[model samples]
Target chain A: DQQVKQNSPSLSVQEGRISILNCDYTNSMFDYFLWYKKYPAEGPTFLISISSIKDKNEDGRFTVFLNKSAKHLSLHIVPSQPGDSAVYFCAASAINNDMRFGAGTRLTVKP
Target chain B: DVKVTQSSRYLVKRTGEKVFLECVQDMDHENMFWYRQDPGLGLRLIYFSYDVKMKEKGDIPEGYSVSREKKERFSLILESASTNQTSMYLCASSYPGTSGFSSYNEQFFGPGTRLTVL
Candidate 1:
């Protein structure tokens, strides 16, 4: 069974607009959540993260929102740039365990 | 800067062949992981090592084995290469959390190796 899921396979948005990518998890023990971005042929790089105790965390143009009650989380990228196009993966981990990754959503920011 | 390096960027092998994928990290991280990424399947962990000579199986461990003989090196071995094993292999390393960054789960990844089995 997949503990984490990204229902949307892809998302497209205009440059300078806000792009929202959503994720859901079935495991409640997950206390740490993270987002990673991957370009074609390259490995994934850490983008941003939010702890379960907090509802939101922001880093410059990127923000991650976590709703523990709803078992959902979303990654918001404001002023999405053409360079922001890549495969975005949602990952979560429980205390004292390895992390699990979602299927990933390809986000394309058109100019 | 933290750096993780993989031995190869691409490789092609015939079925029933033995294959080895090597990964090295300069970050001196305590944990090292080997994962395979497939289209629509996401990243699936094959194996991981937390200490030298210590290893653990991840979500998919069949037909895969790992060795951590040195602190900076982790090696994944395929006893017999199969078509189903063909995928992009990725290596990642991470250290135990510090203070405020309680989510020290941030892992640095090496450029992946795309392997193909004939």
Candidate 2:
């Protein structure tokens, strides 16, 4: 069973537009959530993360919103750039630190 | 910056051959993890360690074993590599499991080792 799910496999957005990626989880025990961005042939890099206590967290152009009640979280990239195009993954972890990752959403920023 | 390195970026092996995958982290983090990534399946955990000589089985650990002898290193072993085991293997490290949400607790992944078994 997929405890964490990214229903959208791919998303396309025009350059300078906003890109939003969504993720949902079935495990309510998960209290910490994170986003990772990966480029081809490279390891995934940490993007943004949000805590269960807070609904929103922002890091420059990247922002993550957590909806505890809905078991959903989202990543928002404003004025998306070409470099921002990549496979984005959302991961959730309970108190145990064993993280479960979603299938990932490929973000394509068209120039 | 912390860097997690896998011993090989790619490997090819024959069925029944014993295989060893190594990983090392420079961040001195206490937690390390092994995961296999397959297309459409995302990343599936194979094993993880929180301290030397301590290990735990993950979501898909049927064909894998792990060893953590030192603080900075963790290893994954395949007793007899099989065709179905062929996939990109990744190593990651982070601080101890967090009970609360913290962005800095994000795990850092290695470049990944692509293994092909025939």
TM-score of each model, in listed order: 0.97, 0.95
Show pairs that collide, candidate 2: none
lDDT of 1 by residue, B46-82 (tens): 9988778989899999999999999999999999999
Give per-residue CA lDDT, model 1, range A1-111, as digits (tens). Answer: 889999999999999999999999999999999999999978899999998999999999999999999999999999899999999999999766778999999999999
Q: Once superposed on the true structure, which residue ranges of model 2 sit more than 4 Å away at CA?
A: B97-104
Q: Per-residue alpha-carbon lDDT of model 2 for B41-101, expressed as tens digits? A: 8899999888889898899999899999998999999999999999999999988645432
RMSD of each: 2.0, 2.0
**Candidate 2 lDDT by residue in tens digits, A18-95:** 999999999998988999998988888988888799999999999999999899999999989999999999999877
The lDDT for every candidate, in the order shown, is: 0.93, 0.91
